[model samples]
Target: MAIIAGSTITASQYIACSEKRDKYGHITSRISGASAKAGHMMRDNVFQTPTHTKEYDAVIIGGGVAGLAAARMLHHRGMNNYRLLELESHTGGNASFGSNKYSAFPLGAHYLPIPNTDNQPLLDMLAEAGILTGYNSNGLPVYNETDLCYDPEERLYIHDRWQEGLIPQLGTTKTTQQELKRWLDEMQQLRAIRGTDGRYAFDIPIANSSVDPAFRELDNINMRTYLQQKGYQSEELYWYLDYCCRDDYGAGIDIISAWAGIHYFASRKGKAANADNSQMLTWPQGNGRLVQHLQQFSKEKTLQQTIVYKVTPQGNRVAIDYYDMRLHTTQRIIAKACILATPQFVTQRLIPGGTYDHDFVYSPWLVANITLDRVPESSGYQLCWDNVIYRGKSLGYVYAQQQQLTQVQPERQVVTYYLPLDHLDPVSSRKYAIALEPQQWVKLITDDLEKVHPGIHEVIRDVDITVWGHGMIRPHTGFITGAARAAAQSSPYKNIFYAHSDLSGVSIFEEAFYHGNKAANALADYCS
Candidate 1:
């Protein structure tokens, strides 16, 4: 059967491929080999340098959002004798993006939720970046309308038709509808409910969330167990919550903690004069735009393609040894204070035999940018910024050009698709993801899109896929409440600061920014 513009495909006819080739034959992106290159680092041996050495006030590892944020904070505090190192050629890390003749598309992370008023640091950053317009008489922040996600924010493909929102309510029973409403209402109520200690049920940075035993107990069980205990048997509710779990934490509800699942809903307490928590801030390049803004203060201070292999504490100072890929030489850098902004897995490798030997697990993900010569028509709803296929393993796709204010939309557009490879273990996920040649990845995504847009594969001009072996930190049971996570944040030695989203047991922009600034402040006092 030939593919049609608005044709419907039954489950039997839905062709899924582990391997697919781009019918139009387009080139893969520059960042396509990132995962492979990074995979070989541990196995590759580098000669240590004895003669080459440099000193700075501070030296930071990892040029991701956390490192950049820490570097920016140090710069803002008049600390110019500092340097940040990134293993990759770019600074944004997972928030990095790439552009083509079509549009600038994300390689990994995308939108950001509006910050809550209490999140002063984030709000201050937004204000400085001109994203937050100003405060009203109520003191609520007024976000820039241009920065807010445009109308027609999200759409869902369910039962062969597209709906206005991501939730699958079409063809649902009364019980299903009631369960959906009940869950959402309960989440809204819980958002306002505080722990016994006067902390919100959930909060950004996660560290601010209540440590009350009543709430912390939720961290000991998986989300599925919590739902079962609550007597919620609705598959609809389960699918929605599970989708949310995978979307945010990159893991399924069965593996994610109850606290984390709820945090996914209640944690977003963003109240704006112009927008709500549901409203997001996005751009053509995804969160990379925000990363670009954060880099304004630290780009010149950052050295890319330089990997810090080891970090040890010395007399009142810290020592760092790194290998520069471009220079093909090893060098040593010593600083009065040091911030290890790398992930826990990497941190463990650099400085082994630490008390904080936490069992941190990461979820892998696949991000592909599919360029189209001309847009395709959907059966029920028009394409929106975020689009989801109900109950699919994939988180679906985002329109790269959706955030643009072009009166005349271009014929060419790029759709960035996200697929969290969490169905298997990390090792297996990496294996499966790496096994997929470009063609197989094309089939995997286009096949899923074809279920909603019949001929989405035909309009494709190009496809570029990225495999993140350790995409993001998973908030598993015991990760938040257990002492292991906190221990991971401890620095037994002086003048060495620990900073990374993993220290918070979650990987997000806000957490990274929070820990970065917090470490910078700590390092400032220590250095002084």
Candidate 2:
């Protein structure tokens, strides 16, 4: 089905239609020559009839944690006249889950640490959701003992020995260890220092931090420069830090801001009653289950399947025009308020006509999930919560079946391996990386895993791959505590609002949730 130039339809759209026909054995749309007759014919046959349901007071653009949280908060406030439009068939954009006979497992987001005492709403939400038991004498909330990460929490196979910590130490020389220690000492000092406004230099929620120019200057340089300036140049340390950045921010040290990199280690000040604030709460299904619970609070019928293309302000209401791929329709939703809970890339596309300068950049991620009949035995420590390989571009693997209370049937496990395409130009790298076939991904994961567990490929049963074209947004130099972020929060349209972790310039569950809640509350003020 070759598309003719000057035709009313786009070539890519025609190709997509062809693929659908080939795979599904049906075609309802056509790509004909440009004419009103062709347009009318296509519109009559291809366009999906819009659901003439009652209008919504507000429409949330995403179905991820942020969107769901916004919906949940709005619903709790007795604002049930809202709708959530998600492009995917399922909710929980990144925080998604999958299941088979063995058990349900997380596909993307998996772990969440307890919130700080200051994060009362999050703590309350978790407690209401039965994730917390109670607070201890120190005011830290205790998580369900059963919910804590099991024994053999983490192990790093480095220097031919399985080390107890994620930080590289096995094959490191004295000089490397000393350098690592020195780097940590500097972070500790930064952690202890407070700004002129009596705020912690590296505080969560970002806005609460000090406005000191000296500290804010750290955001001007990339993490690599920051480390280089401090004389912290050890290959092992560099690899470990780079791996950490890739795992969380989806970018390497050079692309990430120094202050943002430091915040990854220093900003978490959460305290728990029976557990340390530093510890995380996770399940085999990842954070997907949490996303599910949040979705339950919203109106399922109001959830539309549409990819928002652009948003235009029309008086007191915002006109949201979106293309529904499934129904092959383009429709508009007018609402008193709107929340753009999408990533920066999508956000940029939506507000192209506006004057918003969001300098946020994002990185791409490639994740491979392998189902094995049995995990290959490791030479160093036994199978732990997270098993990582030494000196690899990838961050090793996580046992997706480990958190199940029910025994894994047939004695098999699933391993989710992650590799961030942290190239100098992530956009181009993502395009090239995405073009690789599934077998290519399987081969990469199998070969990488075989190094630690030899002859393990024979036991593999299935492998699935997911690509985050624009995964986590990077907080480059000057992003954290910058004015661009402040300006982004300002209203672009009278009724439209922006809520995404990307806007915060830091990609974390806390930031995502915080953004959602803030957007919801801010919009709620105009409800009357």
Candidate 3:
């Protein structure tokens, strides 16, 4: 459309430009790697008998972080006779990335917060990946300088101009300022407080959190309700809290459990020699870099483009029936133990007649990687790693190449835009997002960007979209501490184990890694 300042683009031109493929010949559309049709076929009980059968000591169904972690744990335990199956051609699940000629960008998950010092397993993994270089004299781990997020970390477009940080401080009233201070003070106390059980009141992996009922009861109400009960009444505070919920849980304060929302603030207690807890580890390609490290452990044993439709427990073994997308054939694997690392929604279809009644509500998300010929001009602050627009429809965009160490910034820049479809229910939102046309998505994105960066359309070179129907698990009221979650975590059969972030009621890398490792440990114990 070649939109310039003070000029509007025609709908036809917008459609034309939006449909234009990137340098890699990839168009702006929903990611096509997932096996949605195969999932439907599995749901409909449309199965073909396997023409071939194989045997393995263990079988990991799904190739996301959870599954990959399971594979790594199995190898760590000296179990080499195992196979990992993935529906997509590539692994990483939500941590996947895509690239064009200019830069590589994230498809879904983009960053990892510093791991809590108590999370030794995660620390070990990061150390192995060289992200955690070594410990300092004071015992705090030192991270790789290049891997840490660079300077100009965050900024927010508020009061018609970019501010230093995301907090709406530029135009905030005294009441809002006081409320924000109170919230921060309370969160700081909560961050240091431990329960009577001697565990942190809130911790990553969620299971490691204190089991005190006083804190556990927070899961019985929504975050908004919690704020109201505490006499918090600031519009800015409410908006900022809602934004935080949407950024992490893919939902808002009204929908997320108070425990989860508070955990978002209080749980991050990671101390590093070089970076603070607020600092995050990121790359141009996002968490895909971590995935690359994890993939090495499962490289020779992982099978891509394979859909495991059915998993059943035999007398002393587990039978896994899978369909090969490339070969158009079905195969069977008999294993002594099996780990179903898929989400609960997909796991239900794989194992028919399961009695576990889970109330898992996943939030849908839309992520777009926009390639621009030049950086869009803005007021108040220069482009930062994470740039957010106050009260914007989407979470705003991240400067993808902010981690680049080159003195001369590239002429071409890529920014990943994130939008959680939480205006409606998850089902309706998913449908609405999937039904959006390429041009409609382009308009939605460009319209939002124009609000902060006027005439940004003129600089845009390409836009690639990825929609995650079941993006991440949401911890609703009572879901985290409910019986359904407990049942979902248990193994119905002796030879089968469940492992996914959904079981933790919060979809984050640490929980997924924990569950995967937990499942592998259980399987190893069973085999012994």
Off by over 4 Å in 1: 1-39, 42-45, 355-358
User: How many clashes (backbone atoms < 3 Å, residues ≥3 apart in a chain or on different chains) does model 1 have?
Assistant: 3
Give the number of the best model, judged by lDDT: 3
Ranking by lDDT: 3, 1, 2
- The top-ranked prediction according to TM-score is 3
What's the lDDT of the predicted structure labeled candidate 1?
Answer: 0.81
TM-score for each candidate, following the candidate numbering: 0.93, 0.86, 0.94
Question: What is the Cα-based lDDT of residue 226 in candidate 3?
Answer: 97
lDDT of 3 by residue, 1-528 (tens): 322112345667655665663422332444443555766776776668999999999999989999999989998999989999998889999999988887888888889998999899999999999999999999899999999999899999998999888888997889889999999999999999899999999999799899999899999999999999999998888889999999989998999999999999999998999998799999999999889999999999989888788898898988999988899899999999999999988887778586536488888888989987877788898889999988877899998998887878787899999988888788877766666666567667877898998877777767888878889999988998998888888777899998999999888899999999999999988887
Positional deviation of residue 508's Cα in model 3 after best superposition, in angstroms: 0.9
TM-score for predicted model 2 compared with the true structure: 0.86
Error of 2 at 128 (Å): 1.7
User: Model 3: residues >4 Å from true position, as ranges?
Assistant: 1-33, 355-358
Better of 2 and 3 by TM-score: 3
Candidate 1 lDDT tens digits, 1-528: 212112332333434322233342453432273546653664264556645899999998888888888988998888889999888888887888888876898888898898877999999999988899899999999988888999889998888888898877888899988888888998999889898899987889798998888888999999999999988988878998999999888898999999999998888888899887689988888889889898888878889888677787888878888888898888899889888887777777677454335468888888888888765887788989999988886888999998778788787889998988877677777776666567656655777788777777777877877778888898999888777787777677778887888888888889998999999989988877
- Clashes in model 3: which pairs? none
> Which runs in model 2 stand beyond 4 Å of their true positions?
1-54, 299-302, 355-358, 407-410, 481-484
- State how far residue 249 of model 1 sits from its true place (Å): 0.7
- Candidate 2: count the clashes: 7
